[model samples]
Target: MDTTRSARIILVPGFWLGAWAWDEVAAILREQGRDVTALTLPGLEPEHPARGEVSLEDHVGAIEAAIGAGEGPVLLVAHSGAAIPATVALDRNIDRIPRTVWVDTAPVVDGSAMDASFEGDEMPLDALWEEELGQGSMRDLTDEQLAQFRRRAVPEPAGAVRDRPSLTDDRRLDVPATIVCTAYSADDYRSYAEQGASFLAGVLEHRALTMIDLPTGHWPMWSKPAELAAIIADEADAAAR
Candidate 1:
């Protein structure tokens, strides 16, 4: 158990993303002297033959491996669909992680999949930012940024989406969570937790919920990298104390 108290951020991308998605945020965090590791989930490899065979447990094991690589208190940052596997990982190793940051997503008890239509085998980048993601989700992306996103976007494995999560330990809820509320305010997130919204019900009663209002679209690292990094750095600082 490498619990040295310093902070490390292991970023987990949401559907149809890879470690490259966190380049900007990772760079910023690096400047602040925080260790950052962005993960590309198993089966997310470009044309991986095992993609169809990947399961929620595989995803969880992948995240767990990333956390084990770090040397201190780790912060697992999960974006959108990645939250499910991250939550499951925490359930098994909550002591190693001090905080979990969810970007535009939270843990759910049922761990249902988002059936975003995959063109052929993978979800198209345009379909995600243009249709699936809310309008203006990519409004902050520059032409170059958009182009780079298209070039780097990898197909998310269908199995991971459809695979059911298995979390038997309730201790996962004891780990503090910080949700970077994009397109929604801290008040809005709290209200959802209060009302027991389907997406937020599982971790509504978490030991502590540190809500930060970013007010961007789903992909804040693309739209507001600096702000997003600052929020993550703040959380890391808090965790260190």
Candidate 2:
């Protein structure tokens, strides 16, 4: 690994969010001279006409295209639901991705969808917030932050949330991974992996795995942007090495 070589960092936002969600963190990374690209996965754009038709594969292809356009290997940073397609995209483009940082999420196993119970053409942000407000994932967010989030949030396409990710290459297991623990402790996540948690079935299988303790809500990029950027930069440096 060449520690001096800088790799492009691709940031993938979670459900109901676009690349704009990463503005703060991306700005900090840029200040440190790191290349970063924040993505607005299919269907998450405001008033996208064909949003309802966007599938999981569409998100995967978007990630793949980003990696393909970059030079050398890239570092992927996936938040929440974005982890699903990002994991599949990383599997498909294994050679181009040297590492991935899963923020408050884990790389799901093959054939597993982000939410099997999700129904309808889209999941509105209002409905999601109503259900998730009391959840730990929403902790630490201020009233203003929550209000802004709701104002900017878009409806997530059902197919993107419901479709199962296809990971054919076992070599994806060889890629390095870092799990930034938020809304849960690192120990708790390790225990989940030990107990074979369905969503984290692929976590313990990674050849090189690192656990980071970033105690906050699920949206660390908003609540802890500077800390998140530091972690991402450290991992990006590690990936280069």
Candidate 3:
């Protein structure tokens, strides 16, 4: 155990998921000799009493607390919907985070809400929610995977997803940031690649941001844990260099 080589990597799962979602990835990272912490946001666990009322601020606070608990700078990995909270947290506590990795995630630009990111014709959140409810427990995952996921999946806090993110113009941080987009289907891959390119174009224009593409689905940590862990470790190493 080389303590000096240990890097604190905090995993922030997407909506309707918990720390359990990152079990495999965390295990792999640990095996590779990196320190990893998988976070379960306030409303993510079935046992959490505030499951319905947990706000974006609450989730951000949780991430901040986790980062503060660590001894040094952390590499915050935000997946899907968690990207907003993670970005806001880094903005709020820029001193604590060393880097950020957005995994098949969404980034909310200035003055944009989650709702605003979607085009006028698509209803992603609503449609996805309805489909998930109809399918019961897991929508896209296989039976075995869904069983594993359901053991941890709880209803996400309504406010956490609804609230808008607030970021300051003090744009760049001391650490580097990377966005890894994973798309299973060709259409999804193309869509996210375009989104990632557009985002990297905007406010991120002047910042030192890295972007990578993976040939996996949105939940790569579950479907491709080894690959995901390797990519994350590579990013962490790059930041160190």
Candidate 4:
């Protein structure tokens, strides 16, 4: 396999996160002589003024633009809530993205959001979101991490989380994909199964879906960046073959 030609990988962060989340992971990949770019979705950073009105379309547009300017094929590495927008962007620009890697994230089928699967149930996401916002940086993290998280973590746009994506009828993508699972507890794995089984089942058809259990919380890129980057780089090299 020609590893040189497979260096392009784009990292997409989840809701309330910016590209800064991938700083350590990007550094690791770069140390290995790989090309990586971490993107900040609109409304997630202080520079983006449309935090209140940004929609799912805007999120996808930001990723699409990044892929458009890149050279050759890209392996999109999406984390947490980014899986939906990342996949939607690939579906829209199928020619640019050659592979997708979902990490500790919720997978969406067709154009559904992560919340769609819990339509009839009482999910804890709403409460978690409210609590996290109300408590601010005190919600989750040590004192050191809180200061940093506060600088980058911003309020998610209402429409982006609520709106359903527009998907193409084509079920198959031009490139293969893989799912890397990172959960802190057994309950987290069960949650992924319950909310994202439908989407995961579909991904199994056109690609080789692999799951790696990271004992860290949802953000392995921050907790174990070197390991995460190695897994991603290895999978990307294999996918190119």
Each prediction's whole-model lDDT (CA):
0.77, 0.88, 0.69, 0.68
TM-score, candidate 1, is 0.86
- Superposed model 2: Cα runs more than 4 Å off: 1-4
Clashing pairs in 2: none
Tens-digit lDDT track for model 2 on 3-117? Answer: 3476789999999999999999999999888889999988888979977689998998999888888687799999988989999998888878888899999888889887878
Please list the Cα RMSD from the true structure of every candidate, rounded to 1 decimal place: 3.4, 1.9, 5.1, 5.2
Alpha carbon deviation, residue 141, candidate 3 (Å): 4.6
Per-residue alpha-carbon lDDT of model 4 for 128-229, expressed as tens digits?
655655644133345676557655576666656666777783543536666666553435454546675654534433443455665655667766778888
Question: Considering summed lDDT, which 10 consecutive residues are worst modelled in model 1?
Answer: 115-124
Over 91-151, each residue of candidate 3 has an lDDT whose tens digit, in order, gives 8777666677888764445443455333332122344754655643232456688566545
Model 1 Cα lDDT, one tens digit per residue, 1-241: 2224458888999887888889999998887677889998987777778666677688899999988885778878899889888888888887888777899888656545554333244455665655743566666677898788778777677766666676777777777888888967778777887886766765465766677788777789989999998888877766666
Evaluate residue 75 in candidate 4 and report its C-alpha lDDT on the 0 to 100 scale: 84
Better of 1 and 4 by TM-score: 1
Worst 10 residues of 3 by lDDT: 116-125
> For this target, which candidate reaches the highest TM-score against the unseen true structure?
2
The candidate maximizing lDDT is 2
How much does candidate 2 score in TM-score? 0.95
Per-candidate total of colliding backbone pairs: 0, 0, 0, 0
